[model samples]
Target: MTPRPADQRFDVVVVGAGVIGTAIAARLSSTSARVCLLEATDDVAEGASKGNAGITSSYYAAPGTLESDVIATSYRRWDDVCRRLDVPFRRIGAVMAALTSDEADGLPGELANAKACGVAASIVSGDQARRLEPLIGPDCIQGLVLPDEGIIDPMRLCVGFAELAARNGVQVRFDSPVIDIESQDGRVVAVITPQARIETSFVVNAAGLFADQISELAGGTNFKMWPRKGEYWLIDRDWGRTLRHIVFAAPLPDSKGIHVVPTTNGTALLGPSVTDSDRRYDKTTDAEMLAHVTEKTKRLVPSVPMDRAIKAFAAIRPASEKKVRIEVDEVVPNLVHAINRSTGVSSSLGIADRVAELLAGAGLDLTVRTDALDHIPTVRRLLLDPEPETLAALDPRYTQVVCACEDVSAAEIQAALEMAVPARSIDGVRKRTRATAGRCQGSVCMAGVTFMCSLAQNRAPGDVVVTAAGTAGA
Candidate 1:
């Protein structure tokens, strides 16, 4: 692979392209901060951000922490971001269902904690739970309803933020993994990567699971985070609306337990059984975990048949065995450490705003920025509207259905291929246009999008890759 030139510097360098890193990069770009976002993978959100259940959580957070503040505010902020980006989001509530006396008795503490954290949560009986989610097992004895909880497509959210950041002149470098952090006198000087060397004054370590390594590279690794792998199962779109909200089991010391989430893309997701693992990037879903997850999920929603599960995957959650760590590096004066929290997704946007505010407080002039960053992504009405006027207004390609399973049109795929950071691979196209992520799982549409990306990018089919590693052509 040819290395790209990095003849430019920036005010800040965010060393990860996970959900948190993307959000921070996008937010920081709103200022005069010349920012560069670095990612190890070829695309954003290929790590934990891609898999796992994509639920937008409330401050189900433990109270009196920076995370709680951001998580609480982010729940609302995410709703607005999703709207403006035309990213599909569902305001589906979440339920913490209890099936036993012990579980039911433990509910009050969760409710009180939620209230103390200023989250809107209520306790409900089995009948109420059934009424809220009719497919839930009749054995459910009690539950807590979190009305503001939501589900977001993580990849789309990351992509939207990236596109918006690019619109504001922030350079996001894919496949640029920071090899070293060049610093002097406990202040950031530059980030050294194989492809580019980004000179920066401030650095943000939002590398998700590998954040520890990035921190160590930057001369600040006072904390350590272990990876807790969570496996997930995806049901067919036919069972999409069977559940009105995200359903959960009460939290255990190890993990949040299994959840049944109806995603924004009209499909039901299950599992996410948390298990300790040493592998940082082990995304393989284990059979034992799958068996346990399938059994536990059936207890919550009996009608969800295991045979209908089309995809089972895994994501690693960064957890600290010591304590949740969120602090500016004491050793490094200009660096802020935001790493090792399991619920980072819930607090990502809020974390970005807080980091920016902190930098401003530290005498950084973050006020200077472009006049207005326009981020209104076009919503293709081809799938949403079949009316003649709507169809006519869209390029004639709107009439051409490219991926029938997800209702993705040729116009959408073409636009995705031509966007700020064009979809180079099949999964890139999937992230932008939802091409091969449907029930058929790329069996039918893979060839079409791959060929289109190859033709549009003027690359031979051999150059085209699918998903993360596998190749489709040549």
Candidate 2:
């Protein structure tokens, strides 16, 4: 690992590369400030951003709260942001079904919350809910319809932010974990990593699960973050194609309950059983938890094809005493914290704006850059295009499909490898191009994808790893 050149000072250094941090970095890039985004992992979206349900909820937060405010603002801006970045986002809407009268009684409260938050919501009878989604279980007695709720690709969302930030002159340094935050006279001075010592007056602690640890290094408030694991099951696209909208059980006191979501890429997402745990980085799924997920999901949408389940994974959300904390540090000057449990993605754009405003009020320059790029070229996906012959004529590599399950071409893989924030591993390329994320789960296309990655990295096929420090030839 080579160190960043000496005397590289930045106006602001943002820690973590999750959706929140990347969003802030991207927003800050619009200014003339010299900004740098630091990530402990080899690539972005390696934490809570990579896994978890991808729904952009319209009214998940309580009214008059910071989360609700951000969610409302983000809901309005999400479509434009996705279009500008060329990321996949769909406004398919969502239905929260109630199987019992007791549950139905809670619908009024939810409807009120939606009204207070300015989110469009309506209460529908069970038959009306069935008309909206025929596959909903017969046990559903009533439901709440949220027409603006949608799903998005979390990987593309984070990657687009980072790529756009990089295009606008924001330096992205991967594999750089902050070892210490030096302060003098109650103000941040420099950030020390093993590979570099960056001089900066301000630092934003958006480190997700490790935000508390990062704050401690900066001598900020002592906030503890516990990990809450959410396990998910990915159903095959063949079954997902039948589902027209996101279906959910009524919200519980402590959790959102299980949901059946039709993702933007045509696959269905289910589960996310919230379990309180002490382990900070435990992402392992258990048989018992997964079994509960299938049972609960079936209760909501009995027609869901559990037999077509293709993958099971887990993500850890950062649970804090305060449900969400997004404010400048009280004790440490020039330091900010953006922490949340499950609504980070849905609230990211608003979070970025608020963080930028805070930085400006704190005396950081917010001069607009005239040469900043506004958009990046959308990667050409064969599955999305209607005429393959037209694309094949432009680049012969477009015709050479590498991952048949995903219809991903060699050209797309190579294109991802050459992006502003280029892919460094097979998983990186998967997040960018969906090369090996299909029904087969890479069993059929792993070899071809690995060979391509090997060629891209100038390494032998046997030595290729899925991600940084991951298993070779996985």
Candidate 3:
């Protein structure tokens, strides 16, 4: 995947386009330095960012952990950032349920940990928990209520971050995987991607699953990362509307046990049962594990409607003993490694700020630009709007629904393909515009969406795949 020749130069190059990488790129855009964001996939958030519980947790790790500090720092900023970027975010609270006496005994410990992390949490009786969310199982004895735990559209959040970064003069290139690193005198000079050799003084390895390999290529720290897979079932909005808050299982040491988490799209996400594996790109879902997830989540909330299943998705986060890794590479000073095993979407903004600080300490001029944009233009979503007639007048293409289940219009799909980091495939359009991601799962509108994508990309319909172009698997 080596490029032919060196083409362009930049002051900083940010690798990966997950939520963390995009956030870092957006933060770097405020500086005067020339920044470029590179993604190995066909679009942003094709990694763990694409598939997650999507909860903006108020408290995740232990006290004083970098993960906790980052989550705390970014917790209060979501309201302002989401407003500016027009990202969908719901500040719905979460209830950590305990179904037995042994699990209930851990409630006080959870409360203490939340307080130590400066999170707003309190212990509630099962009665109060049931009152808070009537969907709770009758067997629950106690609950830890986190009022700040919220749900967000992680895909839109990442997209908005990259969009604002691109608007502020940060170049973004997709389908460009880093092939090699060129160093001179123990300093990174350029990065070799499949598309071109990008000359840069600074390189940030924010690649999620392949971050360790990126570090190895840059002559950075020696570390290994294994994939920690989590399986989840997407419940339709019909049942999602019945759940008021997130219901969680009592906890496990290495993972948060299966739970029923809500998403910003008015749907609920269940399970996310964790499994350790060496496979980096295994997005396959297991029926047995899925059944386990369903059963566990049912115990968490007995009233949950299991018949309202939309689909199943799996995501694997890069895991290591260290939960958060945001520091300058010991072997390569200019090459910074920014890796967050978990809480990536929740702690993304803080990670970006921390990475910027590291880059500044490394002699990169990070004087904030006065003329940088504070926000990008707003996107009109049919789901959020009440007056479809008014919208159809502004653009008649809005009258043509490309995704009936999601209320996605042809105009929205077109805009997705013509954005700062435009959609290149059918999955790209689905990620941005939710065109093919509805309850129908593109069964009714795949042909129309594919035709539109074909016309926009100037390729035959056969060339377009349902998934992103450079994705690892189905």
Best TM-score goes to which candidate?
2
What lDDT tens digits, residue by residue, belong to model 1 across residues 298-364? Answer: 8888898777777888888876653345567778877876664566677778878888887776667
* Model 1 worst lDDT window (10 residues): 1-10
Best by lDDT: 2
lDDT of each: 0.79, 0.89, 0.88
Residue 131 shift from truth in candidate 2, angstroms? 0.9
TM-score of each: 0.94, 0.97, 0.96
How many Å off is the CA of 107 in candidate 3?
A: 1.1
RMSD of each: 2.8, 2.2, 2.3
Off by over 4 Å in 3: 1-5, 386-389, 469-474
Clashing pairs in 3: none
Q: Cα RMSD for candidate 3?
A: 2.3
> What is the alpha-carbon lDDT of model 2 when measured against the actual structure?
0.89
State each candidate's clash count: 0, 0, 0
Pairs of colliding residues, candidate 2: none
